[model samples]
Target: MVTAALALCVRTGAGAVIAATVFLTVLSVTLGGSVLADTPLWLPAMPAWPLTATGARLPVALVLGALLLTVSTGLAHRELSRAASR
Candidate 1:
């Protein structure tokens, strides 16, 4: 899901958003795994959100990210197509 968002964002030339999404996704995965492993690292414990709540948040974030990327891509594609016609 995150990967699809990243790809769409990159396709739209939104470097900042793409970078942010990539960073967050990596951080989320790393932290999630570390927490699950019960590592003694000083990192903060994952928040106590319920499983269903956490699950719900993920799809929302992914959808929002995808929408932003899709809009950006559409705009970029329109510009490129227009330019090509000139």
Candidate 2:
């Protein structure tokens, strides 16, 4: 998804969103992995020690990060397609 966003940013010259999208992508992956590992069905620990204590906040953060990425991707795609048609 980050890759797609980067491509869109490049094609549309929307460099401003690239750093933010990359950061969010990394954050979402980290939180998602931590949440998965926290589950009883998975392991008790993750390599991300800093995230180990996020507790319930992890889920909220993950969801919001995902939402931001989704919105960014959609807007980027829309802009890319619009640019292509011109």
Q: Please name the candidate that would achieve the greatest TM-score relative to the true structure.
A: 2
Spell out the clash pairs found in candidate 1.
none
TM-score of each candidate structure, all chains considered together? 0.34, 0.44
lDDT of 2 by residue, 1-86 (tens): 46456656656556655675666556546654655646541222322433553777567556755776788687767766777798
What's the TM for model 1? 0.34
Per-model tally of clashing residue pairs:
0, 0
Per-residue lDDT for 49-69 in model 1, tens only? 122125435565456556766
- Number of the predicted model whose lDDT against the real structure is largest: 2
> In model 1, where do residues sit more than 4 Å from their true spots?
1-56
Q: Which stretches of candidate 2 lie over 4 Å from their true place?
A: 1-53
Error of 1 at 13 (Å): 12
Clashes of 1: 0
- Model 1 residue 41 CA deviation (Å) reads 28
Residue pairs that clash (backbone atoms under 3 angstroms), model 2: none
